[model samples]
Target: MKKRSLLFPALLCASLTTPSYAMLNGCVDTTDADKKTAVYFANGILTSPYAAENMAFKMGIAYKNQFKNLHEDSSYEFSDAYNYSQGKLTDIAQVLQQKMDEEGVAGISGYQIYELISSGLNNDPIRAVLAAFLSTTTNAIYTDALLEELGELMTSASVEAIADSLMVNSEHIGLYEANLIAGKRVLIMPHSQGNLFTNNAVAAVKTRQPDWADSIDYFGIANPAALTVGGAGYVTADDDRVIGILSLMENVLASNLDNDPSALPSFFGGDSRSNTNHLIVEDYWDARLASRAVIDTNMLRLAQNTPFPLQIAGTGAIRASLSWGGQPDVDLHAYEPNGRHVYYRSKTGDDGILDVDDTSGFGPENYTVACESVNAGTYQIGVNYFRGNATETAKVTVFLGDGRTITPRELMLNQAEGSYGNDNPATMFEITVTDDGEGNAIYSVQ
Candidate 1:
């Protein structure tokens, strides 16, 4: 239970922090395969996909403001990518609890966490379905009746988190490929769990395109990893509670943290007493000038290393981005005209893959047609209300890479209809394309 008590504050910082990027709320003064690309791969412990999205913009604004002050050229394409969604209080704790249960290692838990999870269970519908799917995926037995039982036990249980890590890291890697292939310089700064995602993505991308290394970079803020995946180094508070606690656990991968007796509290404001130091915006962001300087330094180096103007890898040849909230599970599906179907069940089809899926809530499950994989034909994209019925408002953004990246189709699903996204999904969008007479396919979203 000591772990439970210790975990509550860090958990509180994760789940309770609203979508404000600290003090830089300025009317946020305002991309492509060729624009200088900057992105924020956020930690998954957010309230919704929108929260993650907004946080990305806030981060961009904060950075842009600082970058302008530091260097003359402050133009860059900036966007946000949501980590796998765990929008509810219970969702995040469940992950933490499961980590401990599986590894039999103790770090974050106790009476306080018990209180948090107890209060969150009734409100969280996503984990039950998730448990059923995960359990069944592993050849275990999980009936509808068993879900309730498993749900209770899961407060103290955990699945092999490799699936979660894979889903998020792949999403990040996809962004890198999408942008870098588009001839854009990429800079991604990940916070907390995002450091892991960014690091993995960078390593993976570097492995694929070593010569492109100089074109991409990352800076970990409150970095939990001792090593920077494949980007610039990281800056972390000496007494960061989350980092401190994770460092002590064998099962948890985290950065080494050491407190300096004479270090000023203003620049690195991690407070063990208040337990409020885990938040990036409040703890670091631009508020901590010294650390902010570190981030800008990395940005400057990226500029020097990469001589491309800021560009956004927005909307690939065929991109389907789905986001929803207030429900446990809503799955995204893409039907390729090549007779290949992609969903959680069939995640990869042809060159299109469902790289990111959110069963926790506030999704952003995305399906992308690989950089050079656009076949001329009709592609159907849609969403299935997989579980929970709390009046889910699901939105889908289809980027045609032609001119319609902003066309969003929104749906209000009030019932949990299908367990698996069928050949023909309920909510849908259609994209039509024609191949060049010379054997190249050009597509557009209508």
Candidate 2:
């Protein structure tokens, strides 16, 4: 995986390395101090010192794209609705507004920064239009139900009132006092200091907000091992300098950040990598693992004198194979969900037959049955042709390919046959799968 230097070092040198601009009020400091500069021979032009500017632009584009995927209202306006349980964006917005009101900061700096970045990218005309709509209105909209809930959590004062207090009187740093006054209670990610607007603005919040001394919570979203050397910062969690911190429950999905498999820690479940914005979404795998119980209890019988749907189409070197591992051992078989045995075979000496496998002795081997383009979906995969356990747990892998080399399906089976096949022939067997549910297929029966 690629690595980035600590966010602070770059931030400290931003003013000296890049072009600096002064604001009318002289309140905002967009300066960079002199520091050691490195040169890259690949490009003749010197590297631009404006690190945060680039990140902001990229993050804005990502944010816009994510918003476009959501459902819209009757007029095609992306919903501004906020629900504590669902609309996370709206919730964050409300919180920011409430804090701003309490701190009495004129002209919402944080909101402006976030918007400047968002609008700067020019990816979404809709969002830009919406921002203009909100901008035109002088009164802040806190009509969402989530805003009410968050308001109740407040210490009996509105952010608007507190913001006024900070502007008029305060001995501490401007940002620190401002944050406490605004009722800042946001969860910040690590290595975020170089993000320009967010970093310095937060510092301003910390300095201006008195409550932050015992209200803030600090947390790291990345692995501790992933932290660059000397990256750790001191903040008293017990005293409220930092409130709480949690690891990436699965993978963090933000405007610009996604979990990369190459960057993942081995402890995370699944051979397949996933990226999610919320921890609840990341926890879905655990719920799935638990829900994988045998709801349809049926003994899987071998397909007999039947039309077995081979996943592969035209003839080549199509082969089917099955490999089994995990939990209890299970015999491989094939049938429909209604318990109709379609593929069954019999050994030269045995009375029962097998439907899917070509050779009984070729146990756990790749057997390519004749077939065609099997669309993606769940097909009946089973084990225990004649006599086998009714309720057994095992990991079965199916490999299918187009007549040549076999390709494996993404699904992994956890339970094979019912408790005991010999005792229960009326057992129900059906597994919900996706991706062309048919064709030349191999079963790795465990």
Candidate 3:
């Protein structure tokens, strides 16, 4: 593995210190500034700052190639037709309009045909023609090439080597402080394939300095790692090709971990998305950035909260409760996988029940799952402010069947503003249940 220079040398100098294993053995440093630190790891096929900088250029070429292939396979001037249909007129579109006029189809606008095809009105002649034009453009070839490339680059050994290289290179630069006090904050930003390296690196740290692990926070962008535990945040773009490919790989990796452990690394466990600390952004670039900015601004509030534990009363069951300190009416909303909304109005469902709906003021509201209602699926937990002032925060705690307690580190309701399920409503976290063998159900945060 090759070590690369820092993308922003000054920023690196201000943030990191070389790891001192000797200091971890015995020594005390009480004269360090309490500054926040953040480290970033770049995405796949990119080993250096230079490679990462050229990503936009490479993506442009890849998209061009993809469009060219789509046009060639469809054989209907797909790009021009699609663009024209989108209300953009080019020289090609003008020529096509002239041809349409000659062929007695002049009045049929591209937008009209697009709507017809999109709405599944295939019986219409124009829609049928447009649908046929698009149906021939397959993504099979592109997917195959992408999968092959990822398979070659994303091996356990390669990932470990990258981790080792990053740690080794950072030695002289100095980041890790041995014998540091608790609450010394550090954030790791790993994008795409860097997530693989980051996970392994954290696992390595756990083995070497277990007590120091909690001080680090992981903020993964488009992560593709297996076995993500707590104390991490993730961001992914819906339209990113690398994210789609990695998601497919993650499914296979997760299955193999359960059925064929020998085929993978001994350190490999399961997918990272099943952890309470993990967060998913379903939006595209700009929206994703805006969401991240909000999170980043509230990092201190997120890190400082001590999670309250929710005690479980039975095996294979889930119970969640919300409580606040101020005079506000907060409601707990739990959505089961079967589209069942368990709330104040509809408490009982096939899977869970809302036993306590406290609306009076500063009270604890609760929801629990019956023994027979335990099932393998994802449950979404949220908080709705039924009636309240603009400034109030709610504390949510979840108890799972597997003896795991999940309390979100940052679930502030400062924007509640006496609203229901609008922008102010906060989805605390999601829990996913699966069979743990031995006829038991294991619940994990997703």
How do the residues 304-401 of candidate 2 rate in per-residue lDDT, one tens digit apiece? 11111212111111222332222333344443212223333321101112323322221232222223322222234434323233432222233233
lDDT of 3 by residue, 195-243 (tens): 5545544555444334455655555555555445464655543434444
lDDT of 1 by residue, 148-207 (tens): 665665554332233344445555665565555445667776777666567667877767
Model 1 root mean square deviation, Cα atoms:
17.1
Task: Return the top candidate by lDDT.
Answer: 1
Q: Relative to the true structure, how large is the alpha-carbon lDDT of every model?
A: 0.56, 0.26, 0.42
Instruction: Please identify model 3 stretches exceeding 4 Å from their true place.
Output: 1-316, 417-424
On TM-score, the stronger of 2 and 3 is 3
Question: Which candidate, 1 or 2, has the higher TM-score?
Answer: 1
Off by over 4 Å in 2: 1-244, 247-328, 336-369, 373-380, 385-391, 395-446
- Looking at candidate 1, the ten consecutive residues that score lowest on lDDT are 21-30
Task: Give lDDT: candidate 1, residue 244.
Answer: 68
Candidate 1's C-alpha runs over 4 A off are 1-35, 65-75, 87-157, 160-162, 251-274, 286-289, 307-429, 432-446
Candidates, ranked, lDDT: 1, 3, 2
